[model samples]
Target: MSLDQPAPPAGQDDSTGREFTSALEDDDVLRAEHVSKRFGAVTALVDVNLHLRKGEILGLIGDNGAGKSTLLKILCGFQRPDAGRLIVNGEEVQLRSVDHARALGVDAVYQDLALINQLSVYHNMFLKREKVHWPLLANRGMRRAARNYLDEMGVNIPSVDAQVASLSGGQRQAIAIARTVYSEAKILLLDEPLAAMGVKEAAIIMELVRDLKRRREVSMIIIAHNYGQVLEVCDRVNLLQHGEITLDKQSKDTSVQELNDIVVEEYRRALEQRQRAAS
Candidate 1:
């Protein structure tokens, strides 16, 4: 956005045009307005405004060095955008640290579950944030909560006492997802979550994403390099190029080719813009 570019018409939200029914008329869980991030002489993001709707799975995709991770990091409070507003739930907020984001009910589950393999499902799920008490830990209570949460998520695991190391690949993935959901994770950012699973396991993860979307409070942002995964899980796709948003398309109306074209074209346009600025 530039000074010459006219402002968005007063009182109208930009996200409403997408019309995601699961999202309220004004439900923008995450919003980055005119954001810019820089590292020394490098500008990682510039003039970016992205909105994640409630209960909608937004696919954040880009080629290498396209600032996908950087943008996500900004949202996660790992990095701060030097020149924009960080808004959550329509309020201008400052993401001072990673803990700040987590406290606000924004959690990110990376490709790795950050789980301890030697531990049982219940132990892993309640690892650091346990239901603790003086003199004795609440083991039974934690296991009960784990079991109930898994059942609510429609996941069938043999027992919460089973070691995570013994679970199948898909079951392990589910365990990670299940843990996040139980943590009151209202906004979930999944980084390449489905890239490493087998066919059945991957399908399970995909179904879980869809199932989570039914709730009005749980919005998801799934990052994937694979176009097929984006098409399958995303309600909308945000394509970035050299730290700027090049395309934002609804998954239903946008094709894979369009995403590819936008990616290529944005790179080309970026090169052209750089050449012109240099000249």
Candidate 2:
């Protein structure tokens, strides 16, 4: 398969016998080229290529241990790729740290949310970049700004003064994402934003994501297991398999059944390999 075209879906032949063109354009906000990573004896990624277009939501899905989190970490500069190049806004650059990535308008909101339960919502929003009045912290200013930003993002938290521990799972997740946006991150990497939440809570976050998409002020790469939600919010979808992106298609061009089938086929192949090794 050509680098410009993704491999056909598992079990499906390339009947057209023609290469599919890449969706990437000059407007791509981020791009990863032949990225590879290894730890000790294990390989996390191999020759991975992916891109995020400006003002677009790209869904990344894969089975557990498929190196999805590793890719996100590399993209956000939490970890570095042993090989390959990372490009931001058409410029190839090396990210020395998470702060460096943030400085370049790239940031990630991991599943952990990274908020302090003991801190108030406003405090968590301004975690390390807190405003200070030289001798004392600017508590009132932060509270007001936090409230306004949340309201603008359509996040409905009870109060900016409320402790993060007192909020529900979904509420906490929203605050995490809101805080990232408030920091002026133009490229957001969301690692399982809807991981463990009730239906209503998940809907709240789904709507928040949709609102962000509507604004078109930021580009996002969302790592999600829920195929339905992925299709609902993303403009495009990419499937990572065996440490490489194997399928790239617009969400409207694919279905949940197709994605599930591909994943199930991967599971079957792994089982067969293990059985053969035992023999």
Estimated TM-score for each candidate: 0.80, 0.90
lDDT of 1 by residue, 153-236 (tens): 888899999989888878887888888778888998887788778887888888888888775358988888888889878989
Which residue pairs overlap in candidate 2's backbone?
none
TM-score of 1: 0.80
Candidate 2 lands at a TM-score of: 0.90
Best candidate according to TM-score: 2
How displaced is residue 158 in candidate 2, in Å?
1.8
Deviation in Å, model 2, residue 194 alpha carbon = 0.7
lDDT of 2 by residue, 198-233 (tens): 999999998888888778478999999999999999
lDDT of each: 0.82, 0.91
